[model samples]
Target: MTNNTLLLFSRLYHHDSRVFKEFLNQLPNDEQTMPINSTIKFEQQTSANHSVPDGAITQESFKIVIETKLYGQEDIDQIIKHTDSFDGEKNKYLMLINVHQIHEDYKVKIRNKLNEKGTDVQLIDTAFEDIITSFRSVINEYDTEMSMIIDDYEDYCNGANLISIEDRLMRALPVGDTLDHNFKYKLYYAPASRSYNRRHRYLGLYTRKEIKGVGKIELIVDADYYKESKKFKWEVVEGNKDQLTDEVIDNIVQSMFHGEEEFGYQIYKGHRFFIVPEFIETKFEKVSPGGLLGAKYFDLTDYGLVKEELDTQLIAEKLKEETWK
Candidate 1:
């Protein structure tokens, strides 16, 4: 078969949106639409399972909780399989993850373990670096290259092999001295499977004014999910008028998109998990500093719906949204 069809998305903030949009131009006939006035809709976006101190330590700004659900190992295997299949050769893959969504209980489970185990530091670093050097063995081991982003230095140090700046500099000095993977290294900081070690687009940090004019809310849903189900987190609320809660979204997803028979309810350990992660949509609105955008919902579906509602409500309250068009 021919590989004529290609799918692309802007999953992270650091990723230049232009790269993806440019690909669309190559399509024989492609049409797209975007929002006129967009906010810094994460304009940005992390997945992390944080490790917690036993017996609970001091207070924290936000509570880290874990919500586990049990999914059949077969399901997970299938997911991994599908991920590999879709992220084929030539088309590099990066799991653009929002690591922040895990429940408080789940978040605290991923802390660094102090496994001294009498493992020598030098040996450990050497082993780790050696593993990295031999990790892929050869270039393009399989489908979907892996990269991760860790926000804190602790995780970063633990997860990534400390890149030698001096070594890199010497290697990069003129064309005489350069490493083979330099091209890959220069393009991406890290190639990891889990979001914990991978970078994410943090569009939530900036304000609407920060994003200024990001055009209309052009969105690319999670690839497979978009193709299989013509609905997205935000679309659920917009099209279905759901409350935008996890349970509600789950209900919408199970009832509407993928029926229970086609794909059983995806429960991991004990919590219901969405197969396809959330996507950010560009929207326009005004708000008082820290003013409630009607109501804030952390769940992607609810958040998207609520944000859209607030934008609409604010637009109705103001003449600006109408003026934008």
Candidate 2:
């Protein structure tokens, strides 16, 4: 199945865009090949004149006939209208929206063409900018691995497992409402018997528990003195952010968490003994030195390290950490 798609990728490689092209090339043959009535390049609006491969994507299948200069939602509607004209047993047209001199929002807008699958557009994992960011690191690794092999410029490349880098980016890329369990966190804390005042920097501890389900988690933390309002104020952050703790000294002047202070610094976001607001905001990032700690499904390669290996458990703490609104 991966082999069928590999054909189209080979041609994408020759183009100037190495990252997108290489990613296209590396797609393992997938058996999920759909009947491609035709593929359109949205850069210039026009129909491709090439012959569609019978159940196989060929090298030149991605070629464009005319560079589409259309922009805005109206342009997208026009394209969708045109795409409907193509005879698909089930209208499966592959469209690439590549406007070179545009913003990221525009790119996202292009992907938002909204298809029948409830999905507006499908984005391939690898892209041009990702490769550029990683190019230096990859070259450095290549230099180290094959120093002995390269006698001259002609024989210079080490070409290590570049797929790993691409895969890393792919794993980080969140799709739809589907959350990556790897990015999920869980409960890890000592027990707290009694509640404390908000002014006293109350320490929170969580009893061990597991998380389940699919949806965006809304986090909440109660403010100590919302007496009149009768509403709890929440301390929240993005899905997998972690908080650092430093009970040792008052050097934490601003109290707004001024980065890592010492070695014994424990990690915490809120207290165990307090009630929280219903809807807290995730306003901070790079929360602490602890970073966001969660075990991904893919991280469970070694059975020896695992006490429990359910897919849900793999990132329970993470999902809980993010979802405990």
Candidate 3:
């Protein structure tokens, strides 16, 4: 079914306009819990559907006007013109919502115009991506109705291709076991190669986990810091290996297995190990001794690594299950 942005939002507010209050509290530095019994209006107009605001939530203490543009760029003048329409004595705010992208230039231009007009109306810019993030932030506290509403909104965003790849990676972190203590993941948009005309998506796994016996591990997958064409020079940036007088490589290997029963051991020549061309070094890198020098994965396959070849939606679903746990 075709979903209009306004209708989707109406459904959300229909569930409980308190969600709107929750949303306001979620904004940075706007931490006050708004009073209950607020009223929501759709297609708010000066007379009858004239100078209409996309939506608004008004209460005794505050008024919020939201203008949503899902298909095209928003006209900055629309919001600027509405600053005079607010009649309440409470604090007032105007929010501009977009689906595809938010232009930094738009904010600057609006601020400049407001300054010229001596308008004190506060402006807040947000996008569908931001809404999704905010929803995820509080999904744990949502009741059944709120959860369903979130699911529908998320499905609509995905169907519209409005969800960023980084969003998927961030959502997947809790599900993946290979991550480090923080389970952080970052997605990079790579510039066009000599062959392709457009940029491509690349993901980086910054951390991983292992049994206590394995000591420590770090992984960087698909980052520019390590190249497949180049060999990695491994060093003991810390620990007693740097003080070794002889058999440094052997000593490091011994340290890896000492006091622990592990089958795999890494062997290298001298202080440097040359990675082979066949190794490719694309999927994972085990960070060397120092700290976060190189990128690699720890227990990736078992932890649900989402790669290009893997089904992202499936992994996301699985991760969502893990997140609630």
Those runs of model 2 whose alpha carbons end farther than 4 Å from true positions after fitting are: 1-43, 47-126, 129-325
Candidate 3 global TM-score: 0.44
Per-residue lDDT of candidate 3, residues 39-155 (tens digit): 655554332123667666565656666676754445767667767667753677777766534545556788788778776667777677777677656545638766777777888
Candidate 2, residue 76: lDDT: 45
State the TM-score for model 1: 0.15
| Residue 197's lDDT in candidate 1 | 28
lDDT of 1 by residue, 37-63 (tens): 221121011122332111110112211
Candidate 2: residue 224 Cα off by (Å) = 16
Worst 10 residues of 2 by lDDT: 166-175
Candidate 3 minimal-lDDT segment of 10 residues: 273-282
The runs of at least 3 residues in candidate 3 whose Cα sits more than 4 Å from the true structure, single-residue gaps closed, are 1-20, 28-50, 71-74, 139-142, 166-325
Ten contiguous residues with the weakest lDDT in model 1 = 1-10
Which numbered prediction scores highest in TM-score against the true structure? 3
Q: What C-alpha lDDT values do all the predictions have?
A: 0.22, 0.26, 0.44
TM-score comparison, 1 vs 2, better candidate: 2
